[model samples]
Target: MEIFLQQLINGVTLGSIYGLIAIGYTMVFGIIGMVNFAHGDVFMVSTFIALIAFLALTQILGATSLPFCFIAVLIGAMVLTSLWSYMIERLAYRRLRGSFRLAPLISAIGMSIFLSNLVYVLQGPRNKSMPPLFNDVIQVTQGGGYDVTLSVKQILIVAVTALLLAGFWLLVQKTSLGRAQRACEQDSRMAALLGIDVDRTISLTFVIGAALAAVAGVLYMLYYGVVNSSDGFIPGVKAFTAAVLGGIGSLPGAVLGGLLIGLIETFWSAYFSSDYKDVAAFSILAVTLIFMPSGLFGRPDVEKV
Candidate 1:
């Protein structure tokens, strides 16, 4: 039981990071109904940005104040990645937007390849390692006489995820910008007819999605202390699985699905076999789709006869 509790903590913490990346997937899908394949690579790039920025600040320049340095690196990564996303939408995706659906799909795939290799060329193919940050642990002992362990980093991940999610929810639900976004999601043509800037909205969507992905990238790097040029693909796929399991286009569903996937992966590794954890997450995705295709919080297709 104690072990279970400990794994639970780990799962939630990992899930929070997944949830952050999943938001990027779900948001872009909600607005445009297309998967952004390069998004995962975009996340990888963000991590690199954070790594370089952190290294320059702490190692090269000899700066103190860990919190401030982390914040600066995180923000810098988010901004750079957000620019990358915007350009992707503009230069690669925008021109192909209304064309054959396959055009954008292929473009995204090509972009993914391009970005991954770009990182490979720039940063080399080796895994980049960092000194551990936020290594403090908090221990808990239940009445059953088992000890459960928690870390400050884990707590930071959960808290930051919660806060960001709350702010994002408010932006999507309460703001005028949110209304414009929902309008475009329903029908881009109609939204444009109603005087909304459809293109700008889509661009903003990309920016926001990339920003969230950037945050996930930084958090994951901090937690693991190691990153590679090709590291984005697996987590990206898992996050996509999470987006699907939670129901694409639904914000809260993404978080819920992320947490569930995290728990399943963690518990499977702990009690069953570490080797099959990824397989378990994929299986859950398949089972969930078979049972409920629209996702837990997604709306059903309304066909007009």
Candidate 2:
């Protein structure tokens, strides 16, 4: 019971990160019907941005307030990563929107490669480590010769995720922007006919998605205390699986999938071999695709005559 509780805590924290990244995938696909394969790399880039921002705050500026520094780093990473995603949408994806579907997919792959290599060149191949910030743990329970503990970082990760999701959910459900996004999701051409700026709406979707990815990146770095250029690929893939498993175009579904994946990974690692954790997560993806391709909450795609 103690082990189960501990793994549950760990799983929720990890799943929150994955859900943040997965929301990016689902939002983009929801809006434009294309996967931003470079998204994971964008998350990767945000970690670097966060790293630099945190360093600039502490090492260069001599700032000492941990809370203030974390806030600044998060805002900086979100803004810059949003800008990067915006440019990618404008320059790399905008022009290709009317082209063949394969063109965009291929372009996305190229962008992913470019971002990874660019980071590799700029940051080098070495793993970047940060000074640990939240090492304190709270004992949740103690019994049966075992103790269940939760770290400050875990609490922060879960809290931040819940808060962000609440804000995000409101943004999507209550705001005009959300309505516009829904319009575009239904039919971009029809939305354009209604005087809605399809391009701007789509661009904002990318921006929002990138901002979420940035948050995930920062939290991930804080949780793990280290990062590498190659770090994006696996997490990105897992997040994508989450998106797909939950129904790629459904935002709430993405989060649900992420939590499930996180729980699966942690529990599997705890009870089973650590090596097959990835296999277990991916297997969920395969099973979901084979038996329920539309995902748990995703609507079936309707073909227009």
**Displacement of the residue 114 alpha carbon in candidate 1, Å:** 1.1
The best candidate by lDDT is: 2
- Model 2 TM: 0.98
What's the number of clashes in each of the models?
Answer: 0, 0
Query: Per-prediction TM-score, please?
Result: 0.95, 0.98
Say which candidate scores most in TM-score: 2
User: In model 2, what is the error at residue 73, expressed in angstroms?
Assistant: 0.7
lDDT of 2 by residue, 154-245 (tens): 99999989999999999999999999998999889999999999999999999999999999999999999899999888899899999999
Error of 1 at 96 (Å): 1.7
Off by over 4 Å in 1: 142-146, 303-305
- After best superposition, candidate 2 residue 64: deviation in angstroms? 0.1
Question: Each prediction's Cα RMSD?
Answer: 1.6, 1.0
